[model samples]
Target: MTTTHQERPLAVLVGVQLPGVDDVEHAADLAELGRLVQTLGFDVIATVSQRRGALAAAAVLGEGKLKELAELTGGSGVVPSGAPERKNKARARRAAESGEDDEDDALGGDDDEGDADGAGSRGARRATVVAVDHDISPSQARNLERATGAQVLDRAGVIIEIFHRHARSREAKLEVEIARLNYVAPRLRETGGGGDRQRGGIGGKGAGESALELDRRKIRDRIAELKQELAAIQREQSTRRALRQGQRRVALVGYTNAGKSSLMRALTGSEVLVADKLFATLDTTVRALHPEVRPRILISDTVGFIKKLPHDLVASFRSTLDEALEASLLLYVADASDPTFRDQLGVTRSVLSEIGASEVPSRLLLNKVDRLSEDERDALRLEFPEATLLSAKIPADVAALRESLIAHFEASMVEAELLLPYAKQSLIGEIYENARVLSEEYGDDGGRLAVRAHPAALDRLRSLLAR
Candidate 1:
C-alpha cells in the first residue's frame, strides 16, 4: 500500500489587545495560541500582535496590520511561480485587504520568505496559515483570508481543530463532530460562479438553493444525527452511573494540562494518559481511589477547560461534564507554577456554574507545587490559605489528598445498628453493597449489624428493613 505523509504548515500567530485588556494576559493568550497551533502539528513562524481601541468591522485587524500579514503570506508583492494566476491576483489582494483567503495551504508550496522576522525577507518561506488568537466573525475571517492570501483560523476554529484531533472515544468523537459541524455550518461559503444554480420556474418551489446551502443543510442533518447518537450514549452513561449511585464520587476538574491526570494516577494507581499537551485527555476516565475504602470512592478525570472555549464545544460536552454534577466533591486542580492559574481557576468556575455544578462542594488543589519555588509556594499559601497545595507526582501529597477525600466522605456518613431478620436476609446483601459494615452478629432468627454510610444509604436500607 502506498503511504501519504502530511507536512507541517508554517503559521503566523495573531492577537489583538482591546481597550481595558491587560498586556500580560493578551501576551499569554497569544503564547497559548502558539501552543495550540503546535498541538495541531503546525510550526509557528511568527506572531502578529496589536493594541486597538476597537476591532475593525470588516477585518479584525487594522489596515497597516493587514498589510503586514499580507507581506508575510504573499511574499515581496510578487506572486511566486505556481502561485495563483495574474487574473486572480486582484481578488487575492482584496481578500487579503479584508483579512480573508480563498482556501487553506495546509500542505502548500515552498516559501520565498523564510526570514526569522516573517518580513518576507529574501529566500524566506511565506507563512502558510494565519492563526488568530481571538474569535473573529465569519465575515472578518473571510476578509482576513482574502487580504493575507492564506488560511485564516480564529481562536475558536483552532480550538475546535485541536478537539477534533484529540477526541478518541465514540462519545468524544461524536461530541467533537457535532461541535465542529455547528461551527462550520455557518462559515460555509460558495466559491466561484457555481453558486448561481437554479431549478424550476417557480418563485419558491424550485430547488434554487446553491451548493453552499445544500452543504449547510447536510451539515445540519449530520449534526442532528450526531446529537441523537450522543443522546443514546449519554443514556448508557447514565445507566452506568446509576449502578454506582451509592458510592461517593470525586471529580478532578481544572484547566488544561493542570496535572489532573497525574493526580488521578497518583491517587487511583490507574495509568491515565498524561501528557504536557493541552487537552491530551479528551475522554473521561474513571477509576477507584487507591487505599480503597468501603463503598469504594470513584474518581473521574474529565476534559479540562480553557480560556474562550467554543460555546458549541461546551454545549456538546455537557453530558460528559455532568460527571461534575454527579460528583459529591470536585477537586479544582491548578498548576501552581503558572502565574495565570488564578484566571484558569476562574474559567473552570464559570464553566462549572454554566453546567449547574456550582452547588457541588469543591476544594481548590494548587498542584505541581514541586515546580514552584519556596517563595512562590509561600505566596500562594498566603494568597489562598484554605487551598490545598501539593504535587501529584509525590506519593505523600497524593496520600494526603486521598485522605482529605476520605475525610469528606466520612464526615457525611451516619452510624446505625440494625437487627436484620432472617426472613429479610436479602436486604443484608444490599447493606453490604452500599455501606461500611463495621460489625456483624449472628443469632437464631436474624443477624445484627453496625454500619456507617451516607444518610441516604441508611434511609434506603431502613426502608427495606421496615418493609
Candidate 2:
C-alpha cells in the first residue's frame, strides 16, 4: 500500500469591518481567526479585511473588495501582477492609517510567491482555501468559492473543522461529528441535474428524491444515530455523576486557549494535555484537586467556549458541559492580558446561560496575569473586584488558587459528633477518609469522634451508625 502525505493547504483569511465596530477589536478578531486557521493545520498566506457600511448579501464583501482579495489568491477576479507594488503600498498605507505597524505578517508568516500543493512551479500561489472571519451564509460561501476558485469556509466552518480535528474521546468524536454533519447538511448540493430518481420505499417516497435530498437524509439519519449514542453516553456520565453527588465540584469554564488546561494541571497536579491552540482540550477531564482535603474536591476542565460558537456545536456538547451545570462552583477563566478578555468573559457567560448553568456560582479567574503590566493588573482589579488574578505557571499563584478552593469547600462543612460501638471500629477509617477528625475519645463501647465534614457525609455516617 502506498501512503500519501499531503502538504498543508494554504489559506487566505478575509474579514469585513462594519460601521459602529471598533477597528482595533475587529483587527483582534481577525488575528484570532488567523490563529484558528493555523490551529486547523492551514498555512495562512494572507490576511485581508475590508471596511464597508454593511455586509453584502451575495458575498459579504463588495465586488471591488472581493476582486482585491481574489488578486492575492491568484483567482479569476484579478491577477496580482498588474498592480503588485500598488497593492503592497496600499496595505502599508492601511497599516499606517490604522496607527499600527505592519502586523499582517504576524498572522502566520511572510507572504511569498510560489506554487501551492504542486499546482504551479513559478507563478503566484493559489490559496487552497478562503477563510472568512465572519459567519457567512452557505450561499455566500458557494459564491466566494465560485469567484475565488477555492474551498470557502466561514468562521463557524473553520471552528467546526478545528473541533473535528481535535476531538479524541468517543463522546467528543460523536458530538463533533453530529455538529459537523449539521453544518454540512445545509451546504450539500447536487452537481448534476438528476432529480428523476424513482424509488418505491418509504424513505425515498413521493415518486423521487434528488441527490441533494438523499445526501441530506443521510446526514439527518447520521445525526440521529450519533445523538442516540450520545444519549447512552450521557446516561453513563449521569450515573458517574450521581456516584459523586456529595463531593464538591469546581468546573473551569473559559474562552478557548485561555490557559484552562494549564490551570487544571496546576490545581490538580496531574499530567493534563496543555496546548496553546484553540480547542486543544475537547474532552472533559476530571481530577481530584491535589493536596486533597476532607470531603474531596474534584475539578473538571471542559471544552472552551468562543465568540460566535455554533449553536449546533453547543447543543451537541451540552452533555459534556453538564459538568459545569452540576458543579458547585464555576471558575470563569480568562486571559487577563488580552485587551478583549472582558468581551471573552461575556461570551463565556452567554454560553453558560444557554446551557442552563447561569445560576451556578461563578468566580472570575484572571489567568495569565504574568503577561500583564502592573498598570493593567490594577485596571483589571478595578474592573472585576471579585476576580482572582493569577498565573498558572507561578507556584505561589497556583497555591493561592488551591487554598482559595479549599477555603470555599471548607466553608460548607458541618461539625458533628458521632458515637461508635466497639464492633464498629471499621467506621473510624471511613471518617478519616471523608472528614477532618478534630478529636477522638476511646470509651468502653468504642469511640466518640468529633469531625467536620460535608453535610451529606455526616448524614451518611449517622445512618451507618444507626444500622
Candidate 3:
C-alpha cells in the first residue's frame, strides 16, 4: 500500500503574514490551508511563509520567500517577462537530460538538490501545486504560477474546489457549480491558440469572440442556468421547510471538521457522513431527534464555516444555510480539544451574522471534550460557563444534550386544555401527535386532554378540533 507522490499530487503551501495579524492566527490559517489542500487530495510536502506589511502585488510573496518556495517545487522562482520560447527550450532540455517527459517535469529547474527542507532528494518527485493561503488576484496567481512553474490555487479556489467535489444533493451541486464558475470566470486565461477569434456576424465577416471571451461567456451562461435550477430546488426546499414549520428544529452550525456531523449522528441516530477532512459535509441533512420524544424535535446539520469563507460560496449555499436562519435554535458546536477553537467559534458567529441569523437564539456547544485533559476541561468550563461541554462519542453526554434540547423547546411551550366531542373523537390522535399529553380522560361525551406545545401547534390543534 505504498503511495507515491504521483498518486497524490504534491503541494507547497504559501502564506503572507500581514501586519495586525497575530502570529499564532497566521500559523493556524496556513495549517488550515494545508488541510484544505489535503482535502483536495494533495499531499502537502512543505510550507512557505513570511511576515510582510502586505502581500506582494505580483506574487503574494516576497522575492526571497518566493525563491525558497520554488526550491520545493524545483521552479526558477522568477516570472517570465519575455522570450518565453527560450525558457521553454531550456526547460525542455532539462527534462530530456533527466529522462522525464511529463509536463510536470518540464517545469523543473536545472537544480536537482530537491526540496528546500530535504524532504525530496535528487531525481525525486517535486511539488506540482502551490496553494496560497489567501484570496490572490488573477494576475497574482498567474505570476506565482510562472515563478513556481506549478499550478497555483488561492484560498477561495481551494475551498470552492472542495465544495465542488463534496456536493451531493441536487441543490448543493447546482450551488457549487455556480460558485465554481464564478471563481473560474475571473481566472480564465488564454491558452495556446486561444488568440484566434470565432467568425460571426452576417456572411461571417467579423471576428466575434476570442477563445477566452467565449469561455467566459459560456461560464456566465452556465452560471445563470445553474442559478435558475438552484432557485427551483430552493422553492422545493422551501415547501419542505414550510411543512416542518410546526416542528422544533435545531441546526448544528460550526467550523469545518468541528464534530458537528458527529453530534448530528449522535443526537438523531442517523447515518450522517462524518469525516475528518475539511468541507466533508456540504449537503444539509435533516432527521428527527432519536428516542422519539413527544412533540418530536428535528435536527439539521449545515455546511460548516471557515475563516475567509468565499463570498460566492456563502451566497451559493444561502439556501442550505437558511436551515440555521430558520431554525428554532442553533447549536454552535466547536471542538473543545482544538487549541484554536475560540477563533473557530468566532468565524462561525461572523458567518451567521452575515446571513442575519445573529438574532436567532443559540447555545454554545463545547464538543469533543473527551480528548481534553481534566484540567483543560476545567479551564474551559471556567471560561465558557454557559456552554455545554460534552463529547458526541459519549452516550451520557449525548443524552444530556438531548435533554437540553428538549428543555430549550419546552421553555417556550404553552400549556393548553382541549375538549373533543364524541363526533370529533378521531381528532384525539392528532392532538397526541402534535402536543405533549400530560393527562387524558375519556368522558361519556368524548375525551379531554391537557397538553403543552408551541403556540402555533396549539392553534393548529384548536383549528382541527373546531373543524
What is the lDDT of every predicted structure here? Answer: 0.82, 0.82, 0.84
Question: By lDDT, is 1 or 2 better?
Answer: 1
Q: Which ten residues in a row have the lowest lDDT in candidate 1?
A: 104-113
List runs of model 3 lying over 4 Å from the truth: 1-6, 82-115, 201-207, 419-430, 439-448, 463-467
* All candidates: TM-score: 0.86, 0.84, 0.87
> In candidate 2, which residue pairs clash?
none
Give the per-residue lDDT digits (tens) of candidate 1, residues 48-117.
6666544556676655566666777873332333433223455457657867523321111133134334
lDDT of 1 at 457: 73
Give the lDDT of residue 242 in candidate 2. Answer: 75
Residue 136, candidate 2: Cα error in Å is: 2.0
Model 1 residue runs over 4 Å out of place are: 1-7, 75-123, 198-206, 419-429, 463-467
Best by lDDT: 3
* Candidate 3 TM-score to native: 0.87
The true-structure Cα RMSD of candidate 3 reads: 8.2
Candidate 2 lDDT tens digits, 43-86: 87676666654555666665666775676666675323322212
